[model samples]
Target: MVLLDGLADEGSETVVKPVRFRIGREGVAESVGVDVGWFTARGYGELEPDGLLRLSPVEALYLTKYGRVAVEDDSGHVMGFEELFSRLAEKTANLWRDYVIYMDLRNRRYVVKEGFSPHLRFRVFERGTYPESAAKYLIIPVYEGDDVVVEELLEYVRACRAMNKTAVVAVVDRRNEIVYYTVSLVNLINP
Candidate 1:
């Protein structure tokens, strides 16, 4: 894993000076003067044209969870993880489910980005081939016990095929563990 500047090991323990980010009035977190080279080069967040690193809710949550960034409230008080969690969680449909899958993928070293549509939760690039290569898989998040519609699954598979990518459904169970299934369409001609 690529360690951010302060997350590196210092002698016996890892010293982390979390980069500070202020939650905008719009609820999006923005950090200025951060190590743009470190973040943008690693695909953590978008480096806006105005030069701010604007983190998505999940990105902010992920960084905060690992103590890589500190999120502050409007009054300038730094929020604890739970506070940040509750705030950020309200912004997305299923925060815990998405974060679990995102963290799992990141731990596997895959470059992941938010997918184009709501049903397609994330676009995962091949390990070490981000920015240079197109995404290899479109991940659709499925919570365990949630009804799975066959037509929806077929649509996801067709969409992946149209983009020359594979459709991977990440099932997040009650335990928060994930299992991935590759969905595809196959035709068997009569002999």
Candidate 2:
């Protein structure tokens, strides 16, 4: 409640130290509008959800790292980064790798939107830009240890091309480090 109010008046980058939120029975919390406005406008969340906007654990953790919100688990305890990541990783095996890419992009000041279909992680825009415009690139993260086939790489490129965006592969190493590569299947010229 208070967190939502604070986020309403503030920018997303403003650190809201220990912002309070509780995980509900449905796993979605009542803490809508806190990070959604800035995140969505920058293209992270949907414009709206069924009722209150539901945040994924990754989103919550991202905000928390920036001092945006602090989430309370069902046990009425604050979730530390490790616990939160462990809980969320149960559902997604590549959670940590994806998080590494997410953090890298965020640190670079890209407005990163979590990807939906086509097996991508983020649709990225230049800083201070809105999502209504075309995203500059679509990032599909792959762990360095994962053996990537040529077909899968081509598919990612095709998908981004279809969407009129460039394809970027964020190759994450075991140390949680990242290296970005741009892939293209067509010949294009610089303006």
Candidate 3:
């Protein structure tokens, strides 16, 4: 509620100056100002080893939608929400699904980042733990009609377990509603 209120401050007189970000030819969005640390401090982008604030497509879109950042093409042309979304989505698989879950989690005050592995969609940190601690949850998004491969899922769960994190499967229905399930490996026979 508080997060939503902050995001949807229609009546607030305070105008937030959007930080400018440039989307390069390689499809990565990088900030162009001193707000790099500011964005990273608030859990919006990752501070790369090269000292650049690199934003995932989902993160850039979310920040753009919230008016916290302005995204432009490599040629300095400003992009609207649809244009940016379309361009970025072309490079990301299941873009809409990932955006929905990312927005939901962010609105709920969770610090979310791109997953470390291919099988994971996101790594979610509890409120106030980001930039200092590891994520507590590893999230994988599953659409309603997707085939559930038990062995693959088990592998992902085991990866999360090895990292001391909870593995969460976020099921996105046709209507875009999400439900989360915590998955764990259970040995049927005693070792």
Candidate 4:
């Protein structure tokens, strides 16, 4: 259980109380201190006239001093939080795939093939059954567009670097029915 104090009011000493709570089966508990100016910062819950901290339950769940969960879009959509995240992830993956394809085409090392489910796969140079090495694996999906993808890509790069593998990321820009691709080395061989 962890409790974070709201911003302190003018001339008032900020006091943070501790509490315990569980988020998606993970137990988290800690205490945090808040100064008058820092506690009153925007995006945080505010105190009420009655001296009780006023906070939206949803907002509380989404933002706090410890960690924050993403807030759903303001659109009055009917989909649940999990469903929205899933849809976002799918779209991001498609973008990444498109970017990879564009890069392959530009590099002339890969061609359009019709046998795969995604309708694309990188053709690595050198034959002999493609050695069981990390170099042989190209075009790993890192993310779709959400923060999850960013975190996953970071973790993937870290893991790959730990194993002495190079991590590459391809970016695609789509505008006015045109797709452009850019390839960049994500990081060196160091986790």
Instruction: Give the winner by TM-score.
Output: 1
lDDT of 2 at 159: 83
User: Residue-wise lDDT of candidate 4 within 37-70, one digit each (tens)?
Assistant: 2333332334545433333322233223223322
Model 2: per-residue lDDT, tens digit, 62-171?
A: 76676666777877788877776776666665777777788778777677776755367788887776655667888878878788888988988898888889888888
Compose the digit string of candidate 1's lDDT tens values, residues 55-78: 877888888887878989889899
lDDT of 3 by residue, 53-129 (tens): 88898998898898877898978988888999999988887888999999999989898998986578899998888
Which parts of model 4 are misplaced by more than 4 Å? 1-107, 110-150, 175-191
The TM-score of candidate 3 is 0.88
**lDDT comparing candidate 4 with the true structure:** 0.34
Question: Among all windows of ten consecutive residues in candidate 3, which has the lowest summed lDDT?
Answer: 1-10
Candidate 4 has what TM-score?
0.26
TM-score of each: 0.90, 0.78, 0.88, 0.26
In model 3, the Cα lDDT at residue 136 comes to: 96
Residue pairs with colliding backbones in model 2 are none
What are the per-model C-alpha RMSD values against the true structure? 2.6, 4.7, 3.8, 20.1
Between 1 and 2, whose lDDT is larger? 1
Global Cα lDDT for candidate 2: 0.68
lDDT (C-alpha, whole model) for all candidates: 0.83, 0.68, 0.83, 0.34
